[model samples]
Target: MAGSRTRRSSRTRTTSLTDHLKLPDGYGRPPEQAGPQGLDLARRLRALTGVDEDLLAWVWYERSKYTALGGVVLGTSVIAAFSMWNFVNEAIGEASVLALLPAVVWLLFVLNLDRWLIAPQPNAKRRPGPLLMRLAVALLLGTVIAEPLVLRIFQTAVEERIQEDRHGDVDRLRGNLLRCNPDPSQPDHGTPAGCGSYLLSFGATPGGQSTELDALRKDAAALQKRVDQDSHALEALDTEVREECRQLIRNASSGLLQRTSECLRLRDKAAEYRSTHHTAENERRLVRMNDRIGQDGSRLTRSRGTFLTARNAEITQRVAQERAKQKGIGVLERMQALEALTADHTALFVGVWMVRLLFVLIDVLPVLVKFMSHENSYDRLLSARSNSAVKVHSAAVHAMERESMADLEIKQEVTDQYVRRRKAESVAAHREHVAAMNIRERQTVDSLEEELRRPSTV
Candidate 1:
């Protein structure tokens, strides 16, 4: 009997629990059933994305959430990997560790970037703020990161163009060299004046000059030497004539009283010698020498100045050409070459940005298509079904709570009634027991009195 009572209590508790938790049938299913066409579309989307049907019904009612997520993951990965590769290449020997830290941080940032694309939906209708912000960031990053790589991709073409430019420079330099030394027969031809045999030295006998220049220089030097000798000769003659003439005058004056013919003849001889050597003849010769010297000196000065100026100019031009040739094919040099070859900096700028824009558009395509597409019939049905399920679940919980409260009130009333009755019964029994005790006490007292009276009779 005890075992049977225990089993009965356990069964009652289980029944109550089930009744409390159970919901109405067909609560989660749609009130109006979907046709075959609607079901077919849902099935196709499920197969394509591989999302669970229940999860699709709840969160991704309009589109394939799985496909969208997969695309974002793939694109982000590709972009991150490409960016990291370029960073490593640039910083490998310089600051490998420092470069890697930023690359890792960027990778993490990009991987979690889907949050910006997907998180703004309070409902299906409002546009997401994060989506716009993300697209702008993507475009900027693409431009900065992709430009150098694109330039590198076309390096072969750039190098070829640089070669062509180099050849042009060399040809121009050679032409300038020819202009500096025009004579084909001379050793200076086809060479710069600084390096040519004709302009190796300067002065009366400068090297590597034409025959006419050499003759002119020699004539100028000879005239200069002859003029120096003539000047010294003229000075000596003047001094000798002055001394002889003074001596003649002194002799003639001393013998004035005698009036001798010898003195007179000596004076005449002095006068004749002075006139022959120091007067008109020598003076005329000196004047002629001066004129010739002046003419030759000026001619030589003009010729020398013209030649040196031309030669110096040619030397400067040649030096500049050599430096241009020596400019190596390094990164900075290559960039300069590219600029020179293209010539239009504005066009290059526009082209680089256009490439970046294309990449940004490609990266954001899947996100835009998924979010911007219109909701279909299957989505509406799924949303309705989910709403109905939620309502039924809520109703079941409320009903269970109300029933529990009512049952608790009835149990409380029954317990109170039973307690009152039991109290009343106990009070009545106590009153009767008190009355009986009083009666017993009175009888015992009477018996004691009668016994005392009988004892007296004995």
Candidate 2:
């Protein structure tokens, strides 16, 4: 009885294990046993509940948005990556080193925020609070994780500011080299090669840190001093030019006034000439002379007036011409002087502006150089952040790939199994029908043989 009980218990365990192994076949083994009503009800059920359908549609939309957002984020990150690589390329020169941090940070922020915002989860629960709380927690976690990176970002910014200040000095020196006191003797310092400053500044060997930086500092200071000197000289020149321009303007004003007086005199003289040369009075006098030709003291008076008027007109015209000539000379002289003054003033102002720009550029060069050339703690931090984002993106992609493969495999296996089972059933049915026909044929053959064996009375 004990052995029997053991055997029965073993059977039961085996049965249980078998049941466990037989997972739901999904389809094709047998239709689920159901009452007619149950079957009808199942058939009547909507493919999707309204709310579920809407939610699913929303999810689809969200998925599309998420995909697009992810692509944008990834694209931005790729650009940042290329930018970082470019920074590495320019490592020899400080021109664009500091340019990497902001781009990296921005790319990270976008990628992280998008991922955090769209992280998938079991969304069966409708209550917004738990889901929101979960999302908030995730965001907080992401931020916490990203805190060191943020610090690095801030440090990069500060370092950039410092480097910019230093770069300004370098630029100032460069400007001085180009301008006054330029050593035409010195050969041009060829443009620095790739982003080598970082490698040079932070190499495997720890030698002469202070000495190097101090030298850099000294060079910057010298450049700054020179910039200040140039700026001051430029300012003085500007002031002097302004004063000279003002004096010139005053002189032009005096000349302009004299020209105006001459012009007025010329206008008056021309008017007098026009008045004296009256054709109407002359014509009237001629008419009287003709009418009284033989005996006319009246005709004699008119002729004398006409001769005096012609002489007055000639004298007035000569004076007007002289006055106009004087006025034209004065106007030309004033205009020429005024134009020279304006040109000189313009050139002076332009010179001052150019000098100021050079000073400003010199002052910022060091800082720009430092930020652009060297890797701060932020670069590592941002790199880590980028790696994390990449991992997440990669995991998602792998998961999707796995799911697609699994789906295809399942479909193929189901189709193959179904086809094999259908072929087996068809073969069994054909074999049974063939057997039945053979049995009938054998019985007919047996009847014919028996008849042939029997004796024939006729």
Candidate 3:
């Protein structure tokens, strides 16, 4: 009676547990009341969760739950793909046909990843280690997935900020280059006293031509100085001679100027000065000096022009290089601009974070749902069904192992019996062989005794 009661209670418990898994009578029959076609799509989706569809189909809630999780994976992947599209587009500087490749690849990868994260496992509660590892992975992926979407949410402002920043950099770089490489056409005050930041070792510095030109100009000026002084001294001597020659005593009546000794002396001195200057020779010397000065002047002009031109050219090239360095927009720049936007405005900060967390939540929804949900009817049914199959398979394996063991034991008995029979046969053969040897020895001894008796006769 006790054994009967135990068996009865076990059946009762099983019936109660599996009652929900059972369909209504005739509900699963074909032609009249067929299976739920609505769950066909759900079954396909649930396949991503790596479940037994035949088993899962019986549990409607499990099918719905897993199907929803698969949708989340697909939705998260779409978001990820969109974010990737923006990244690729921004990096390439325009919409690119190639952007679709990376987006599609990333979408598939994220889809697989989220599916793996949400996939069901046996005894998940008992294994905290694997659960925690999956959680960590999901969180890391969430963060990665959230950022690009967050930036995309504020795309307009972020893009504007990025452009503004790039232009600002161009201006700043141009200024630095200009400061470092002073143009030669502009008056070079040399480098400003503390222009350390902008100054470069190589720049549009005026060359030795300026210094050489200055020296040439000074030489030209020196040449004219001696000629001017000689002209001045000769003019003074001529003036003295005229004044002495013109001095006249008032003659008694309409008297002409009389010859004066002082006048004669002045004339002689003027003649000596004229001889030293030598009108024709002095003109020749002045002409040669003027020509040399003109030549020097022309060279000075060319030197200045060349210096300005070279310096200007170098400044243009360097400024252009600097400007190029500051010109382009990129993924990193957009990210940084987003950060700046958030920092500058409280509204933006709150809004941006809200969007970020929303995307992260979306990305990790499947993981969170699987991790945090309490076990429902679906869980119990799946566990019971799977566990039952496992136990049945395990029982079959044990039965095979026992059958193998029995076969091995029977083989062992046969081998032992065969060995015992062989041992008995060998013992009998040894006894017979020993008897035969003893008889032969006795015969030898008798023959030797007879030989001795015969020898005595001889």
Candidate 4:
């Protein structure tokens, strides 16, 4: 009996296990039970993610789901790392502890981004928005990541171009300075020295026309001195004439008016010395000297103006050159050079993009190929098997319901029969009791009658 009980208990446990393995009424059977192909596919999918068959079937259609998702995540990580590296490289020149924050954030974003790319939704129609957004973000990120690396890889050429740009800037500044100076002989002309001293001295020293200006100034001074001497001689002669006229008038007396007139004429004649020293000739010489001085002064002024303008221009050019030198080539400048280089070399740009696209395709290919392929035979078989399971479960439920209804009817009929029999028995028992009581009462009446008859005879 002990052995039998143990065997029965083992059997009950096996039955319970089998019952547990079976699907619920509405739920489908395992894909493996559906067919060999579905079973094979289920095993493959199970091997891929190490998830149970039921859960896998509910989520993914095939093994490619795993491959595609993994590929997307892996590719996103590669691109994101490079992208973050590039950003950190350009922003701070070298990586730092602070840079790691953005790197970590970027990595998390990339991981989540993959999920965002392939996140499941109930409606297939609304999926394109998310898919396109992911693609756009991936493309943008890939471009940003690829551009800096590509440019860095070609650093030699880029640096060379930058050096060329610097030289060009220097040459431009030099040309501007030369144009401003227009005179090479000046100490400050078209040179840093010239520019430095321009404001202090007004370019007055060692200029091209310095000697000529000095000579012209000296000539002007000499002419001025000669004019002054001529004026003094003329004044002395006028004084002598006035004094002689007064003396004549005093000597002639009031009656001799004609003598006074003669004396005035004599004084005028004495003043009129007729040599090269004559007042009229001296005046002419002074006028000639003044005209020459004016011409010399005008020429000197024009020459000075020219030199000063050139000096100012040289100063401006020098200042600009210094500023440009101080601001050297930077990241933006290098980037601009790369852009121009790419424009000039279309093949290079194309090659770089092709490499980037290759990486992107590596990431997205699994998803694209899986989705684009026709429905798998396993999937179709599973669907059919699920439908059949549902139908069978529904039929079994209906049959159980019918059996339950039949059992209920039989139970109800049995209960009614039992109730009726009990009521008949109860009624028969009550009738018998009444009959017994009537007999007893009759007997009692008979006895009483007999006693009364006997009593009357006595």
Cα displacement (angstroms), candidate 4, residue 198, comes to 14
Q: Regarding lDDT, does 1 or 4 come out ahead?
A: 4
lDDT (tens digit, per residue) of candidate 4 on 284-387: 76677667657765766677677667666666666675666645445687788877777889987787667667655654543454344455544454555556
> lDDT tens digits, residues 281-397, model 3?
766766876676577657666765765566556656766776676555677888899889889999999998888888878877788888888766656666777788687567656
Model 2: which ten-residue window has the lowest total lDDT? 198-207
Q: What's the distance in Å from true for residue 354, model 3?
A: 4.1
Tell me the lDDT of candidate 2: 0.43
Residues 330-380, candidate 1, lDDT per residue (tens digit)? 555555665654565667656655765666665565456546666644445
Write the residue-wise lDDT of candidate 2 on 361-451 in tens digits. 3323222232233343323333444565576567656655666677778789999999999999999999999999999999999999999
> Model 2 segments beyond 4 Å from truth?
1-352, 355-373, 399-407, 439-458
Which ranking of candidates, highest TM-score first? 3, 4, 1, 2
Q: How many residue pairs of model 4 clash at the backbone?
A: 1
- The candidate with the higher TM-score, 2 or 3, is 3
TM-score of each: 0.37, 0.22, 0.67, 0.43
Extract clashing residue pairs from model 1.
198-207, 198-208
